[model samples]
Every structure is written in structure tokens, then in C-alpha cells.
Target: MRVVSRLSRVPLPALAVASLVLMTVALTLVFYVAPNDADQGFSQRIFYFHVSIAFTAYACFAAGAWKALRHLWKRDPGADLESYVAVHQGVIFGTLVLLTGSIWAKISWGHWWLWGEDELVLFLVLFLFYCAYFMLRFSVDPGPQRANFSAVYALFGVVLIPVSFLAIRIAKSFVHPEVFTLHGPNFGGWILVTYCVAQAALLLLAYTLYRVELTGKRLDARIRELRFA
Candidate 1:
């Protein structure tokens, strides 16, 4: 709790600057430093961005669910808004996952989308399910009822994360190309370094955006209270 509060106090500018620097470094590593894959060739470069964004989306959704749990179980005063902001960020990143996945698919499989792919279809389902969260959240009047509804929905939606993540492995049908196989990771060397950098960059970017949105919403609430007063 103390740590979280301290983190919340981190300056937005610092986070924004860190995100920008890391993102530039990650891009450089992805394009210039990472060697071309023998199998997928240059097109494999998309994996760095696509997989990192997907993982970041997962992190955001998981964070939202954790905040929602705090709101419901602990009755944390600020958790509701935090959960909403996290989920909103998740949706934004999820959209990127879809777009990048589509591009990867086009390059690898010669299709914009592959319905036969378990991972792709499951991710789409997860994305659409969360998309409904906004509708559910906005339908109720602001108060405890709205907060309760949102919290519960967030909790329910989070269940899909693991399911979607493991769909490729579990499904008997055609699966998306598995980067991490039972034997070991399919690629190594600088590819792993590039992936790690990309993941860090996207997570930092997501956190910066989450904090910015949360701060704006809190300010809006304060302004509303002042007007009412």
C-alpha cells in the first residue's frame, strides 16, 4: 500500500520521458540489432512489437481486475476509478494487438485474419468481451451500484485472459505459431534481447498512459465537486 502510494506520486513527465526513451531504444533494437529469422525472415520482426503489445494488454487487464478486487473486497475508495482507467488502457492496447496480429498474419499466412487459428479467435473473443465492459459501465447512474457492477464485470472478464493465452496450446485444431515450445524458445541471441526491450517499453508506455488518464479523471471529479459546492 505504501509502495503503491509512492508510485502514484511519480511525476507524469518522468514517466513520459522514460517511456519515450525506452521506446526509441526498443525500436532500434527491433529493426537494426535483431537478426532476421531463418524461417519467417524479416517479417518475424513484427513478432517483437505484436507479442509485446499483447502481453502489455494482458498486464493492463490483469491490473484492472486486481484493482476491481480491491474495490469490492477491501472497499478501497480510489480503486474503482483506477480499475476503470486500467481497463480502458487494456482496451487501447488490445486494439493494437489485433492490428499488429493482423499485419503479422498477412505477412505469414497471406490473410488479414485466420479464423482457423485458435489464438487469434480466442484473442478476438477476449477483446470483444472487454469492449462490452464500457457499455456496461456507462449504463448505470454514478454511485455504488455503478461501481459494484463495473467491479463484478471486470472480475468476470479477467477469467478469459488465461483461457485466451493458452488456447493455442489446448486447441486440437490449427494453432498459431508457438514461439515458446515445450523444448525451448524457438529463437535466441539478440532476438530475446529485442523482445525483452520491446516488452519493457510497452509496459512503461501503458503505465504512463494509465497514470495520465487516472489523473485527468480525478481532476474532473474534483472540478465537479467544486462546482457542486
Candidate 2:
């Protein structure tokens, strides 16, 4: 709890600066340092960005679900808004995943989208489900009922994440390449380092954005309360 409180107290500007620096370094490593794939060539470079963003999206969803659990199970006063903001960040990153995945498919497979791909289809379904969440959330009035509904919906998303992630394995017809096989990782050396850097950059960027949005929302709520009072 002390650790969590310390992290929460980190200044927004500092986070923004750190995120920018890491993101710049990550992009430089991806484009310049990482070796080109012998097969896919330059196009394979997108894998660094695409996969990292997808994983970051998953992290955001998972964080949202955990916050939702806190709201419901522990009745944490601030958890509901935290969950909402996290899910919002997840959806933003999820959209980027689809865009990046489509670009990758176009370069590798000569198509923008492949409906037969299990991983692609599952991710789309997961994204759409959360899109529906925003609709449901906005349709209801602000109160405990809305909070409960959003929390339950976020919990459901946590269940979907694993299913979407493992779709390539669960479905025999999937053509998506598995990076982590039973033997080991498919790539190594700078490829691994670049990927790790990219992942860290994206996660930091997402967290920074999450904090910014959450702070703005809290300020707005406070302003409204003051006006009403």
C-alpha cells in the first residue's frame, strides 16, 4: 500500500517527460538498431510496435479489471473512476492494435484484414465488446447503478483477454505466428531488447495518459460539485 501511494503521488509532468523520452528511444531502436527479418524484411519491423501496443492494451484492461474488483469487493471510493479511466485507455490502445495489425497484414499477406485469422477476429471481438461498454456506461445516469454495471463489465473483459490472447493456440486453423513456442522465443539478441524497450515505452505512455485523464476527470467532478453546492 505504501508503494502504491508513492506511485500515485508521482507528478504528471515527470511521467509525461519520462514517457516521451522512452518512446523516442524505443522508436529509434525499432527502426535503426533492430535487424531486419530475413523473411519479412523491413515489414517485420512493425511487429515491435504492433505487439508491444497490443500487450500494453492488455495491461490497461487488466488494471481496469483489478480496480473494478476493488470497487466491488473492497468498496474503494476512488476505484470506480480509476477503472473507467483504465478501460478508456485500453480501448484507445486496442484501436491502435487493429490499425497496426491491419498494416502488418497488408504488407505480409497482401490484405488489410484476414477474417479467417483467429487472433485477429478474437481481438476485434474483444475491442467491440469494450466499445459497447462505453455505450452502456453513457446511457445510464451517474450513480451506484452505473458504477456497478461498469465494474461488472470490466471484470468480464478480464476473462476475454486470455481467450483473445490464446485464440491462435485454441483454434487449430489459426495462421498467426506464435512468438513464444514450446521450445523458446522465436527471436533473440537486439530483437528481444528492442521489443522489451518498446513494451516499457508503451506501458509508460499508457500509464501517463491514464493519470492525466483521471486527474482531469476528478477536477471536473470537483468543479461540478462546487458549483452545485
Candidate 3:
């Protein structure tokens, strides 16, 4: 497999500092600026970060799947690493989705979990599916073959997203008599601005984390070669 001689030359400290500032500001907006939702009240506050993160996680997974496809079809070496890191971030944020979703469910329904909540139920399946991704990663010896297999499986995950969502929706027929809306702040005025800022900040943070982790892993590979050479 081919390797990159050097990673991109962006300043690490600057990236970290910028992401910290963004996170701080975004959290403030999420809690203080966004008005109390009429339907869900205080619990609706969690929706900002929770939904943003969930959407971001989906983006990451889609990105990973795209890279995986490139790796498999085009034989692009760097795609493998990029695909791995993206999926890794997807898994992290997916876990957060489940965590925050559970919190919201508890606040609203007095239960930590509800199988009937379609979005939450979908995330639960995604969470389990992606968790197994790590198992697949660890079980394989690192090589082109491992990369190829991971790529193929990641593609499967993307396909599974819609399938799982449909399955959850179908299951809801027997689970609940009426659908309960997951209330969110109206997309107007300051609420709109807050959601946009929060989303931008979260996406920037995900990118920063992805770059740093990718760089670190690449450096580790270089170090191993130096030590053994």
C-alpha cells in the first residue's frame, strides 16, 4: 500500500484553540439564547446539541462510506485511513446520540428508554451496528485486505441506515397507538441562528478531532517504521 510522505501542515494548537472557542460559544447559545420550547419545555434544550450531533454523525458515516467505496473501487490508499477515522468519529457521536436521547426520553416519559421512539430506536440499531465495526477492525490484521473488508462493511452500514429507519417505523405500529412528536424549537429568529451556530461549531469540532487523530495514527506508523528499519 502507498503512504503519504507528510500530513497537511495546519497548526495543531490553533485548530484545538479554535474548536474550543466554538464549542464554548455554541453551548452558550444552545442553553441561554434558544427559547424554552412550548411542547417539551426544559427538556427541549437538549435537542439542539443532540440533534446536531446526530446529524453530524450521519454525515461522518456517509463520508466514511464514500471513502470506503473509493478505496475498494479506485484503490486509493489514503481513503482507507480517512474512512477508518470518519467511521470512528461516527461511532463516538452515535453513542452520544443514544446517551442524550435516553436523557430526553427520561425527562419526557419517566423512562430511561422507550422502544417505540423511532429515532431513538434507529440510533440503538446504528449504535450496535457501528460498535461491531470496531470489533471487525480489531479482529483483522492491518493490511490491504483488512482495509478492503472494513470498506465493504462500512458501505453496508450506509445501506443499513435507511433500512433500519424503515424497520423502526414499521415496528412502531404495534408499539404505540399514536405518534408523539419530538418537539423542537421553531426555525425562526434567534432559535434559527442558535441552531446554525451550534451545528457549525459541532461540525468544526468533528473535523478538528478527525484531523488530529488521523495525524497521530499516521505518525505512529512512521515511528514504527523508524524503530524497525
TM-score of each: 0.90, 0.90, 0.91
Report lDDT per candidate: 0.86, 0.87, 0.86
Runs of candidate 2 with Cα error greater than 4 angstroms are 1-4, 164-185
Q: After aligning candidate 1 to the native by TM-score, how far in Å is the CA of 147 from where it should be? A: 0.5
- State the lDDT of candidate 3 residue by residue for 46-100, as single tens digits: 8878888999899899989989999999999789999999999998988899999
Error of 2 at 156 (Å): 1.0
Clashes of each: 0, 0, 0
Q: After TM-score superposition, what is the CA distance of residue 161 in candidate 2 from its true location, in Å?
A: 2.4
- Give the Cα RMSD of candidate 2: 3.2
How does model 2 fare in lDDT? 0.87
- For residues 1-229, could you state the per-residue lDDT of candidate 1 as single tens digits? 7876786788999999999999999999999999888777888888898889988988898999999999999999989999999999988988888888888788877899876555566668878988899999888999999999999999998887776657645653444344422122366789899999999999999999999999899999999999999
RMSD of 1: 3.1
